[model samples]
Target: MQKAYKRLMAATIVSFSFGLNHQVSAQSDTYQVVSTSYQKPITTFETYIGNKKIETVRYAFGNAQYINDGVMYGSETDRVVDLKNSKQTVKRLAPAPGQIRKYKDAYYVMSLEDMDHSSLTKYTLDFKKVGKTKKFTGYGRHLILIDNKAYVLADHMKGYNYSIKLHTFDTKSFATLHHETITSMLFAYHMRQVGSQLKIYGIRPEHEEKLTVLSYDVKKQRNVKTMTTNQYVKGGVEKTQTLTKETELIFNQDRMYEINHKTKQVRVLYDSKDDLVDYAYDAKTKTYHVLEEITKTAEFRVKTLNSHFKPIAEYRLKKSDSVSPFRVL
Candidate 1:
């Protein structure tokens, strides 16, 4: 290919055996600021899914917990501040640093210091007080979340060496999810259900640089590399790469890929530090709110993206500004 000059936007050709790498729509939608705050060793935000904080709740963890607690990708202490205005009083577990998420007349908490010294956890309200929550010893480095039924993402962990295994169960009388292993380190994860699907997105990459904005698809138990193309010459020469008709580093190493259940097209989105990746949508208000990384800060700028993935309402949330990325209802 000659004259390959794709500056930034994600443009692709056809669907590959792996999957389609989508770009943020160029048109601006709508995104209204539900709320904003800044208070942590790292810059992170949270927003409710509803109008009032009581009706909805948003909680984000600090960066320091990533390494110490191993919550997400950082070891920051498990410090959760209820940015909600609801009557639900979040009771702290103890000096261990944990909060019981409460919202919409429901409640739950990420208890257990360590479940087999493995497993990954999120920060969502734990509703069902299910059956015996067994802390499977030697689990994996993945967070486990059970919806109405008993479906767990058996999080495997080995000092940050993570591997994932999926499991399911029938909703019976009671369930108890727990961790069996406990070290001097702190651990806390959240979970819940939203809409028709269970959406899971993590900003932490395998050591940051390892899993850059890239998509790795598994088809038929094979590590299928879709969206990747190969070149063949009359001389029987062949070369393979994840480039379109034109080759460019359009996709970052830390990109997040989501397959549209409707379009069946694999769309890529990311919450990272690369200049090419950004996201903003008003599932709450502004119809659509966009975020761009500042040149010299950890804050994501606020903006509105059009239907074509273009910016509309623009506002910069400096490193000092703590704005939640997206709301989970």
Candidate 2:
């Protein structure tokens, strides 16, 4: 009887230890929050923990633009906010109708919605427009500024399918350096600068199982077939990358997917359920933030989660003129 009792206690201890180990392993690593800046008519800065507001800060004037980088910069029609120093300065230039993007030393203003015609304009540090307006054809989004130029993936519709084109222009003079059709796809998934080469990561119509990462050599004015993988073209060749771990984000109508490249497993981080209004991700922090609509209240709660999908922080804000709690720009 004594031996049997001791055996039972040992098994229970082992089981308890296993459970505790699982819980710790499942917990996400502590995400290093770079900074969070969001605003409405008046700008505010905050930190959150799982739908609870920890701290709320308000700026003097203007709608705030939150850039994910640790440095805090906000813009309004008439001014810009330096959150670090808590300073607001009047914008010296004219009002821009489209979105304003700050590159290394200059700011760019362009409208992609003007499908008929569009031009990229440069502005100096003081917000004064600089040089001749750079013009490009068709509807282009996903602005990538690198090496004193602008690279964008554009789309045009045909009879049944769509044509995707990459256009590069000098940021100063807006001169067309390289313009060519890479592949015709339903849509572009992502585009970013990979070292000196511009990489376009997208899915072909029929190749949903695999993603094509196309590398373009702007100087060569041709696609580097070597760097291209999983071409997805019916007759095209395929070169696979030995991806041990990779992350891809896919945004559906109301669902946000975090995809595992090796496993090809997709986890829905945000859904339209629960009256969740909007979601945004901070790449630096590797964290996902969501805004959930509060029930029977004019207040909305903002929740922050780590990369492993663990709750980190939350915040609450009064419903104001600003519909978006966080800005991706």
Candidate 3:
């Protein structure tokens, strides 16, 4: 009887230990995702963990444009929200912030002072002001950090003629490296860095039949190639997400295409009936988290896809009139 009792106690102890370890493993695998509404005045930020809604934070000052390391950067308000604790911190250092990039212990922000002027400002991780660049005479649209260099894409107007320019800055010292005009005809919207090439996509002014893609070599510091495609001619490419070092995923309305930069080939990954809002890829689990909007039902669907873009699991969010389309961060 004593031996049997000891054996039962040992089995219970092992079972408890196994269950505890499993819980911890599951928690470690869980990742956080942030989504924001497209409405005005009050910007709502929704935080999710594996298709489950965890927290909703609303900022009345401005829209949150970027998120990094559990902190959300607003457009007009420098607000930071701790995802784990749901605490909000406001810092009014960079006003009218457009794009934010973090390098080492500093944060670089593009501050749009007015319609014609934009400045690149640096701040500490805790939102303390460090320094700022001289205001560029253009409207800064995109900011990208590649290696130790920071690239800013801005639009400049010389009388009625408008030109798109690319400005490069040293990340370590914030020194101006290069300021080059990319195009005088195309209204550039988005850019992606694949390998050593910076691919800029834009639409020709007054001409909407084709989308122009300009490839710029970073090492050579010159325009290398230009191509036009009819794939996303009407509205242009909405979003570009890097899938690998050599390939990226571009979204056009409800369709998603995988483009190989080396071969210059584009392949459709998924043509969904619903509108694809946003998507994110997890390299650790080889999974894709995609968010889609059901137009008929007016609901949002969170989908988990395998490495091959096959749907593995899906969850439908409750319909809400207050929130607009969501973008997975």
Q: What is the lDDT of residue 34 in candidate 3?
A: 43
Per-residue C-alpha lDDT of model 2 across residues 1-329, encoded as one tens digit per residue: 99999999999999999787545533422222222224334555554443334566665545444342223344335344433354454453433323456788877765544544456777776667788776666665556778777877776665565678887788767888877886634556556665566766666655652445566776677787422233232212111211123655544334455545455455565454434544566666666666666656645665666766666565555566554454321
Per-residue error for 42 in candidate 1, Å, reads 11
Which window of ten consecutive residues has the lowest lDDT sum in model 3? Answer: 25-34
The C-alpha RMSD in Å for every predicted model, in order, reads 14.1, 7.3, 8.7
The TM-score that candidate 3 achieves is 0.74
Candidate lDDT values, in order? 0.32, 0.55, 0.71
Instruction: Please give, for residues 20-120, the per-residue lDDT of candidate 3 as tens digits.
Output: 86455334333333445545544565666545667876655335666655456666565544334434555566667787777778777887877778888
In angstroms, how far off is 107's CA in candidate 1?
Answer: 3.3
Q: Of 1 and 2, which scores higher on lDDT?
A: 2
- Error in Å for residue 180 of model 2: 2.0
Q: Which residue runs of candidate 1 sit more than 4 Å off their true CA positions?
A: 1-90, 94-106, 110-133, 138-148, 157-163, 169-280, 283-287, 295-299, 318-329
Clashing pairs in 3: none
TM agreement with the true structure for every prediction:
0.41, 0.61, 0.74
Which regions in candidate 3 have their CA more than 4 angstroms from the true location?
1-62, 78-88, 146-148, 170-175, 204-209, 243-246, 321-325
